[model samples]
Target: MSEKATLKRSLGLWAIVALGLGYMTPTVVFDTFGIVAKQTNGVVPLAYIVALVVMLFTAISYGKMVRVFPSAGSAYTYTRETMGANAGFLVGWASLLDYLLLPLVNALIIRLYMESLFPEIPAWIWVVLYVAVVTFINVWSMGSTSGLNSLLVIFTVLLVVTFIVLASVQLYQGMGAGTLFTLNPIAHENVQAVAVLTGATIVCFSFIGFDAITMYTEEAANPNTVPRAIFLTVLIGGGIFFIAAYYTQALFPDLGVFHLLDDTLPEIGLYVGGKAFQLIFLAGAFAATVASGLASHASVSRLLYVMGRNGVLPRKAFGYVHPKFRTPAFNVIFVGAVSLLAIGPSLELISAVINFGALIAFTFVNLSVIAYFAFQQKRYKRPVDIFSYIIMPSIGAGFTGVLWYFLHADAFIGGIVWVSIGISYMLFLTKFFRTKMVDLDFDEADRPIGKEA
Candidate 1:
C-alpha cells in the first residue's frame, strides 16, 4: 500500500524556538504593564517573576512529557497516552478554546490597532485582511511561516531594546525612580503579597506560548530538540518580560502617569520617545500581533489535524494535509473562517475565555507526567525520579490551580459552555462509552529524526 502523508519534519531548535517566541508575543509585556502595575501596586517586575517561576515548573513538565511522547497533539497527545482516550479527547477539546481563540484575539487586537490609526476604516475590513494574510502564509508551508515569524520576532526584539535604552536614559535623568538600580520597582512600602500573587495570576497568560512548543514536536529536526526548545522558549521569553518590566516600572513606578492603565504601550511610547517614536512603537505592536496570529493559527490547525487523524474530529477535512504544500490546508482555512468572529467579540471577553483552556491544559500536562512516569512506568522509587516525577509536577499543578482560583467569572461561564459541547460530541462519537476511540497510529514515521519508532 502507498504510505500515508505525514507532517514534514524540517524545524531546527532555533526555528522551533522562534515560533514559540512568536506565539508568546514578547511585546505583550508592555501592552499589559500598566494594568499589572496597578494590580501589584507598582511591582510589575515582581509579579512577572512569580509568574515565571510558576511557568518554569510547568515548562519542565512539558519537556519531560514531550521527551517520551513526541507528537503534534501536545497536551492532548500526552494526556491521552498516559491517562486514557476519553481524558485525552477532553483535554484536546478544552485546549481548542485556547488554541482556537488565540488567533482570533490577535485578529481582534489588529482591528483595534487599525481603528486607532485609521478611524475612517471599518474594523471588520482590518480583521478580514489580517486573517487572510496569515492564513495564506500558513497554508503555504511551515518553512515560510517560520522564516517570516523569525524576522518579525527579531524586529520586535530590537524595538524592545530601543525602548529599554530610552527608558534608562530617562531614568538616569531623574525620571520616575531617578535611577534604574533600586528595589522600588520590585517592591515598595505598600507592596502586598496577595496583590503581587494576583498580578502573577494575570501575567501568567503572557507565558502561554511556551507550552505550545510541543505542538511542533512532529515537525522538529530532532524530536529531542523539542524539550530544549520548550525550556528555552520559556526562559528566553520570561527574561524579555522581566527586563522590560523592570525598566518600565522604574520609569513610571505609579499608575498616575498612565492615562490608559488598561493598555500603557501607547502612552509609554509617547512619553519615552515622541510622536515619531509612537508610530514606531505601534508598528512594533502590529508586528507582534501578526507574529502571534501566524503562530496561534498554525498551532490550532495542527491540533485539529491530529484530532481529526485520530477520528475525534472529521477525518477527511481536519486530517487532510495537502500533497503539494504539505500543510493542513483545510484546517487552516477553517481557522481563518473562525477568525472572522474577531469582528464581533471584544478583545477582553475572548482573552478571558482563552485563559480557561490554557490553564486547564497546563494543569493536566503536569498530571500527565505523574500518571505516565510514576504510575505507568513506576519511576518514583529513586530519589531523583521522585523529585522529577512526583514533587516538581505537583508544584506545577498547585501553581496553576492557584491561578484557576483567580480566573474571571466570564471565563467560567464560557469554559463550562464549551466543555458541555465537547462532552455531548464526545458521547456521540463513543456511543455513550460502549466502544473505544479509534486508536491513532504513532508509527516509526512520526518519531523524532534519528530515532527508531
Candidate 2:
C-alpha cells in the first residue's frame, strides 16, 4: 500500500474522549470492586481516590509529550525522539505487553462474565464473538469505532447513574447503613496501611485507559485536543469510579459476609435493584468490555504501525494501512488473533503481565518528560513549565516506582523476562548499536513530535 493510505485525521475532542473511555472501560469498577474492597478492608473509594491522584501525574506527563511529539507512536515515539532509538525500543517492547494483553483481558472478561450469565453457552464461543466484533469495527475506520465507542460509553455511564440512584433509594429506605454518606469507604476502623496501598495498586488498573487518549494524536482534529482530552478522560473516569465504589461499598458494609470475593458486585446488584438491576448491570458491563476491547485493539495496532513503519519491527507486516479504510489492517487483525490466547490463561496471570508493562511504560513516560525538558529542550514558561516538566513527573515516577516495587513478584519476573527478549531482538536489529537504522520520515508517519520536521 502507498503511504497515502496512512491514518486519516478526523477525530474531535469528544470522539477522542469516547475512545479513551472505551479503552479505560468505566465498568471495570464492578469487575474489580470485590478484590479492591477485600484488599482495603472496605475502603474501596479511598483506594480509587489515591490511584486517581497518582495517575494524574502520569496523565500530565503524557499530555506534555503530545506537545513535543504528537505522533501515533505514543510512548514509543516520545521515548525514541527524546531518549534515543535504543531506549525507545525498550519502552516500546515493554509497552507491547500493555497495549496487546489489555484487549485480550477485556475480551476474556466478557467471556467469563457471559459464561457466568448463561452457563449453557460455551466460553470460547463468547471469546471468539468479542474478538471478531472488536476486530471488524476497528478495521472499518476510526469514525465507526469512535461512534460505537461513544454510544457504548453512554450506556455504561447511564447504567452507573442508575446504580447510584437505585442504591441511594435503597439507602434512604433502610438499606445497609440507612444513609447515603459515610466515611467507612474512605477510612474504616479496620483499615491497614499496607492493605490500602495494595488495594490502590489494583485500583490503578482502572486509570490505564485515560493515557491512551494520546495514541490518537495523529488522527485528532487539533494536536492540542490530545492533551485536554487526556485530562478529561482521567477526570471523568475518576468521577465515575469514585461514585460507583462509594455507593457499592456503602450498600455492602460487611465485605466478610460475601462467600466469594469475585461475586460481590453482582450480588450487590440484586440487593440495590433486584434481578432486573442485575441484568442491566451485566449488560452495561458487557458493553463496556466490548467498547474497551475496541479501543485497546486500535491502540495496539497504532503502536505496531509506528514501530513497523520506523523499521523498529518488520515494516512489511506492521507498517501498512488499508487503502480503503486507512486503518492498520494487518496489525489490527494480528492483535485480534493474539487476543485468542484469552481462552486459556488465568486472569491473575494476564493482569500481572499487563500491570507490569503499564508501570514500566508509565515510568518511562515520566522519565521521557524529564529528559525532554532537562536535556533535549526546555521551553520557557513563567512557572508552570518547571513544575509541568520536572516536579510533577518526579512525583509520578516516585509513585509508579513504589507501585512497581510492591507489584506481585510474578509480574516483576514476567516483565523482566519480556524485556530480556526485547534486548535480544534489539541486539539483532542494531548489531549492538554499531548500526544505524532509517526511520520512516516524520511527515509520512502522521504528525511531527517536535516543533518542526
Candidate 3:
C-alpha cells in the first residue's frame, strides 16, 4: 500500500520556536550549569558563553542548509546529500540514540520531581506513566502536541525570567554574602584551556534539543521561517541559560547547591529566593521536563517515520502512520516504550548513555557543517570563506573533543557499546535487508554571485 502524503505544513513560526525552546529550557536552567560547576568550579556561565560561541557557527551552517533542504531528516539529509548514503545513515543511526535517550532522561527527571510531591508512588511507575502519557499525546495529532507545547513554553519562559530577575535583584540589593561576580569560586587557580573546553561540553549538552525544531520542517507553515527560529531559539535559550547560571553563581558563590546534583529536587528555590521561589521553580521544572519529553517524542517519531519511508527499517510497521490522525503512529509508540523500559535501570546510567550519544551527534553535526561548506565550495564554486567553512568547525570540534574526553569512563564505554550496536545493525541492513539507497541533490540551490568563497 502507498504511504500517506507527507504531513501538512500547519505549524506557524512562533509555535515552532516554542516547540524547540520548550524542549531545551527545562534542563538547561536547572540541571546543566550544575554539571559545568562540577567541572569548572562555579564558573559555569563562562563555560556556557564559550559553548554558545562554538555552537553559533554550527547553528549558522544549519540555518543555511535547512533553507536549501527543507526535509524532516535534518543532518541525516544534509550529510547524505553532500557526502554519501553511508555517511547519512551513520549520522541517522547516531542521532537515533540522541533523540531516544532524551525522552528517557526527561521522563526520569520528571519522575524524580514527581516523587518529591507524591513520595509514595514508585519512581519506576512515574517513569512508565510519564512516557505513556507523552506517547499518547504524540500519537494523537501534531497540532495538539504543538498547542500544548506552546502553552507550556510560555509558562517555562515566564518562570525562568522571573527567577533571573529575582536573583539579579537580590544580588544588587546585597541581600546575601555572595559575590556579584568573581572567578575566585572556580576550583583551579590556574585554569587550563582543556578544563574550560571540558566544562563547555557538559554545558553544551544542556543546549542539545534546541535544534529539534528542524525535525518539523515538513510541518512548518513556511519552511523559510525555520532558519530564523533556529537562530532565535539558540540565542534566547542559550542566553537565558547563561544568565541563570551567572545569577546562580552570584547568589551562592560557593556552588554548594550544585552538590545536590544527585539530590532529587535540587533545592534551587533556596538558592534563588526562598520557600516560595522554590515551589515556583519546582513547578516550572516539572513543566519543562514534561515538555521536553513531549518534544522528544514528537521529533524521534518523525525521524523514525522518515527513516522507515527510506526503507532502512521494517517499512510496513515502522513507516505506519495514523489513518485518522495523520501522525507517525507506530514510531511514536515504539520510542515511548523503549524510553519507559530504560528508566528502570538507573537514572545516572541513563543520563550518561544519553549524554554520550548527544556528544557524538554534536561532534558530527559540527563536522558536517564544515564538510558541507567545503563540498559547496569545491562542487559549485560557492564562496563560503575559510572562517565559516574551516575555522569555526575546527574550533567546535576541538572544544567538543575535549569535553568528550572528560566524560565519565562509564559513559565513554556505554557510548562505544551503543555505536557498536548501530554498526552491527547497519551491517545487517546492507547484507540481509539489501536496502536500495538513493542519491540526494544538495546543489539544487545557487549561491549569490560575488559571495565570499
**lDDT by residue (tens digit), candidate 1, 1-453:** 555556688999999999889889988888778778877899999989988988889899999987887654377778889999889888878888888888888888788777666779888999989999999998896544688878888998999999999998999999888987999988789999888877787787788888767767788888988888988999999999999999999998767877656557777888898889889999999888876787678767776776677677788998788877878899999999999899987554676688788888889989999999999999988999999999999999999888777776788899999999998988888799887765643222242221222
- TM-score, cand. 2 vs. native: 0.87
Which regions of candidate 1 deviate over 4 angstroms?
Answer: 1-11, 120-122, 136-145, 218-222, 256-259, 314-330, 344-346, 440-453
Compare candidates 2 and 3 on lDDT and give the better one: 2
TM-score of each: 0.88, 0.87, 0.83
lDDT of 2: 0.78
Ranking by lDDT: 1, 2, 3
Candidate 2 lDDT by residue in tens digits, 90-162: 7778878888899898887887677666779878998898898888888897544578778888888898999
State the C-alpha lDDT per candidate: 0.82, 0.78, 0.68
Task: Report the C-alpha lDDT of model 3 over 1-453, residue by residue, as the tens digit.
Answer: 545445668989898888778778644556644555666666767777877876665676677677767774366667776667777776667667877787777877776676655778777888878888888888886544688878888887788788778877787778444446655434346556666676776666677876667767888888899888888888877888777776776676555544346332456665667778777888778777776777678767776775665566777987677777778789888988888774565455565566676666556666776677676654324445676666676776675666677766777887888788877876776674476444322120111111223
Full ranking by TM-score: 1, 2, 3
Looking at model 2, residue 285 earns an lDDT score of: 82
- Comparing 1 with 2 on lDDT, the higher-scoring candidate is 1
Report the Cα lDDT for residue 20, model 2: 83
Best by lDDT: 1
The all-Cα superposition gives candidate 3 an RMSD in Å to the true structure of: 6.4
